[model samples]
Structures are given as C-alpha cells and as structure tokens.
Target: MKLSLFIFLAAAVLGPELCLATLHNITVKGELLCDNATVSNVKVELREHDTFDPDDTINAVHTDSSGRFEIFGEEDERKLTTFYLRIFHKCDATHPKVCTRATEYDVPEKKLDSVYDMGSISLNLQDNKELGRRYDRDSEECD
Candidate 1:
C-alpha cells in the first residue's frame, strides 16, 4: 500500500508533460500577390486536405515584408498526410468577392514519408469565378 501511494504521488508531481517523437517534417514555401503586387502581413492557413471550413485550419503562418512565406507541419507514423494552403486578401477593396483558393494542393504519400519540400508556389489572389478553372496551373486562390 505504501509503494502504491508513492507511485501516485510521483504521477501527480510530473503532471501531463511528456516528450513524444515526431516522425515527419513537411515544408511548403510560396509567394503571394494580388494583381501583380506582393501582399504582406497576411495570415496563411494550412489545413488537412479534407477540412472544408477555414475556421478549422491546423496551422497559421504570416508572410514576410516581401510577401514570401514558408509553412510547415509534422506527422507521426501516418501512412498518408495531405495538406491544402489558403490565404485571405481583398483583391479590390471597392468590390466584394471571394479571395481564396478553390482547389487544394495534394502532397503525395511518398514525399510525406520524411522531410518534404514543396517549392515555389506562386499564388494569385482573385475571385473564384474570375479564376475560371478549379486547378489553374498559374496560381491558387487567397481570399
């Protein structure tokens, strides 16, 4: 009974702090702009591929003074981890429109196996309707 009491006391003292291993580290880098002008100090959102709602974004990053950004996340032992990035910007303050990417970017499972680099994503901020195609090769939406 005394040994059990001692163990309980130790557990209470340690609290919930613990060290866990991180399996994979992923990095996605990109530049953001609206109508040929770089956008700075905007919140960049990273989300699991299936998360449709912006409020549930997993990670938030900010762009530099030059409108360049790098967002990263870690995964542990998951077979597949896909992510999508988005931003919120006003294309034209006088006009109202949606300013985010309509399609999500997919990171292959093999790449997520370790440290992965998604190089040079150039995103153009425009209305979804004006953007035309869903997966426009030129850019992604940021609204």
Candidate 2:
C-alpha cells in the first residue's frame, strides 16, 4: 500500500509537468504599422515550414482596430523552423510590403516554450525586390 501510494503521488506531481513540456501551443502575435500609424483590416497569414511542405500557409486573420494580429500553431518538425507571416491589404499601392508578400518571423525550437509576442512590426511602405529574402532563399532549398 505504501509503495503504491508513493507511486501515485509521484505521478500526480510530475505528470502535468511532463505533459506540458512535450506539447506546446505556440501563439504568434504582433501589430502592423505603416508610417507610424496603425494599419487596420490587413490580412495576416501564418505560414508553416515542415518536412511535408515547403511553406504551408494557414489562417487569414485580419487586423483589429488597434492593428494587432495573432495566430496559434504547433511545434515544428525540425529544431529550427520558420513561421512566415505574410501581410496583405487594399493599401498595396501605398505599402510595398503589402499584397501577400512574405515578412518572416523565425520561430526557433528553443523559443517554443509558450506564447511569443513578435512585437510591433513596422513597414516603411517602401518597395524592394528583396522583401522576402529569407523565405525566398528557403523556398529554393528547404529540406
């Protein structure tokens, strides 16, 4: 009886922690701003990088009135994975970063402990061919 009780107590104490460590619900959140002003109604997407797909995208959440956006995802297949965030909106003509262009945020394996706040990502509304450099490079070569 004593041994069984000890075993039960040990599991009761350690089971939850072990479970929590194995799986994590990594949430990505951030704000979009253009020219120092909050951009609303912008479509923010979460692109996942896994062995099965190059850059599998999901969710098309629009920015709230405060220009904030958020998304939830599971851990990556590899230790170092990328969660690319592409933004789009009607202001494509004004904001070069708009129009489903890739703005990546690498969610490394070590950072997958809990919710990750990407902070305020600002766009200067400038045009540049090298906008999605990281994702572009990975697209050509991601195993």
Candidate 3:
C-alpha cells in the first residue's frame, strides 16, 4: 500500500535527524603553559555555564608532566560553553607568596557539527601583570 510505503520513508528520514542531535564524545588535546613556557601539574576544567547557578562549577581536569592534557566531553549546542585551563604553582608550607595565584585560560567551545582538535592552546601567565596589579590595588583598598 502507498500509505505503508510513505510511513516507512518518513521513519527513515526522521531517524537520522534524531541521531544527529545526540551528543558525541570529543577528544581535546593541548599544551599547558605559563608565562609563555611549558608548565606541569596544571589544572584543566570543562565547565558548563548553568542557568540556575552562575558561579557553580561542574567538571575539572589536571595536566601531566609534559604540560599535555586531554579531555573527553560531549558538545552541547544549545548553550554557550567554555573550558578553562587553570595554572597554579606548588606552594611551600610556610611561604604562601612563593606560589603564584591561580590563573585561568579560556578554551574555545567545540561545535556540534565538527570534531574538535584543540592542537596547542597556549597560556601566558605573566602577560597579565597589569590585571594582577589591579587586583592587588582593590585588595589594599578593601583592607
């Protein structure tokens, strides 16, 4: 029957569309750097901006010895997303100032239509000295 044939064709078309909307796993690999140099033991996080809580964190990762990191995630198309690579120096027990404050680097969101290869996402901690100075000024004023 023509009705049966039409129904079958409709299912075939709709099935692929439904599957395409599902999230696929992605691998993102990159180098972590500080002050334009390679850094080890850095923390990397894949955070989703939630509508309910703006400042709440979702997921996190850490870098290896060579400053290389890989994160597996499903790309979401509905919302604006970004991953952050955070760098922190190992601190001594007695001297807090010996370790630099944590710095965040933004990772570009992957698109749903394509696979993402992060390649080399470089970070520069010293490049924002002015921003750090501004923070110090605000803290001094608060005190």
Candidate 4:
C-alpha cells in the first residue's frame, strides 16, 4: 500500500512536466550571393541547439541555380526549440585556408511554424560573427 501511494504521488507531481513536449515546425528560405552575383549549389543546414545534449540537424539543402533555397523541418521537444541556419560555401576563399566558410544565422523564435524569409545574403561581405571554417582533408583541391 505504501509503494502504491508513493507511485501515485510521484505521477501526480511529474505527469504534466513529462508530457509537455511540443511539436515545432519552421520554414527557412533565402538567397545567397557572392560579389553581387547569385551563388548556386551552396549547402544550407537547419539545426537545433540543445542544452546538455547534442545538437540536432533538422534539415539540409542546397541553393538552386538562382541561389534560392527553402527548407523546413519539425521536431518534438520538451523545451522551446532553438534553431539556426548553417551555410557552407567557398566564397572569397582566395587563400583557401579552409575547405569552406561556415556561417550561422539564428532564427527568431517568433517565426516558429511560419515561413522566415532571410533576404539576400552576400558571402563576400565579412561575417561579423562567423561560426568557423570547415576543413576537409580528403579534398585534394584548395584555391
């Protein structure tokens, strides 16, 4: 009888918290440019940032011939999901210190479950807070 009561009390206390997971969906679209010209085939990844857990990749895509892209994804999370876009490209890489330049753009939480259009982004411009650079050893080319 004591064990049964304890279990019932525990369930009453934690049931709501355990069942608070929500499904979040987002659509991200943008145009990529380099030196005022459209950059095609650039890789873009939508990701979720987690606390005390490994980050998750929601979706990934490449820019079209017109440098346009639209990607969407959904996930169920107990806490509010944080999202960002990771762009990988080889723009303005004359020295080619790395295989590609990676940049991140944070998505507004208010844009959840809706389309977030990130107007034109120029890769030639300096990335004020660049995430980092990508180095691929298998690639035999660097320019």
C-alpha lDDT score of every prediction, in listed order: 0.56, 0.62, 0.52, 0.86
Which window of 10 residues has the lowest lDDT sum in candidate 3?
A: 128-137
Off by over 4 Å in 4: 1-15, 136-143
Is candidate 1 or 4 superior in TM-score?
4
Give RMSD (Å) of candidate 1 vs. truth: 9.0
Give the residue spans of candidate 1 off by over 4 A.
1-22, 50-56, 77-79, 92-94, 97-104, 108-143
Candidate 2 steric clashes = 0
What's the C-alpha lDDT at position 29 in model 2?
Answer: 87
Residue range with the least summed lDDT across 10 consecutive positions in model 1: 127-136
lDDT, candidate 2, equals 0.62
For candidate 3, the lDDT comes to: 0.52
Error of 2 at 69 (Å): 1.1
Between the candidate structures 1 and 4, which one is better when assessed by lDDT? Answer: 4
How far out, in Å, is residue 83 in model 4? 0.7
Which wins on lDDT, candidate 3 or candidate 4? 4
* Candidate 1 per-residue C-alpha lDDT over 40-103 given as tens digits, one digit per residue, 9 for 90 to 100: 8767766655334433356778889988888877644223456556555444434234433333
The model with the greatest lDDT is 4
Per-model TM-score on C-alpha atoms = 0.51, 0.56, 0.47, 0.82
The stretch of ten residues in a row with the least summed lDDT in candidate 2 is 134-143
Estimate, for each residue in 17-63, the C-alpha lDDT of model 4 and write its tens digit.
88999999999998999989999989899999999988999999999
Better of 2 and 3 by lDDT: 2
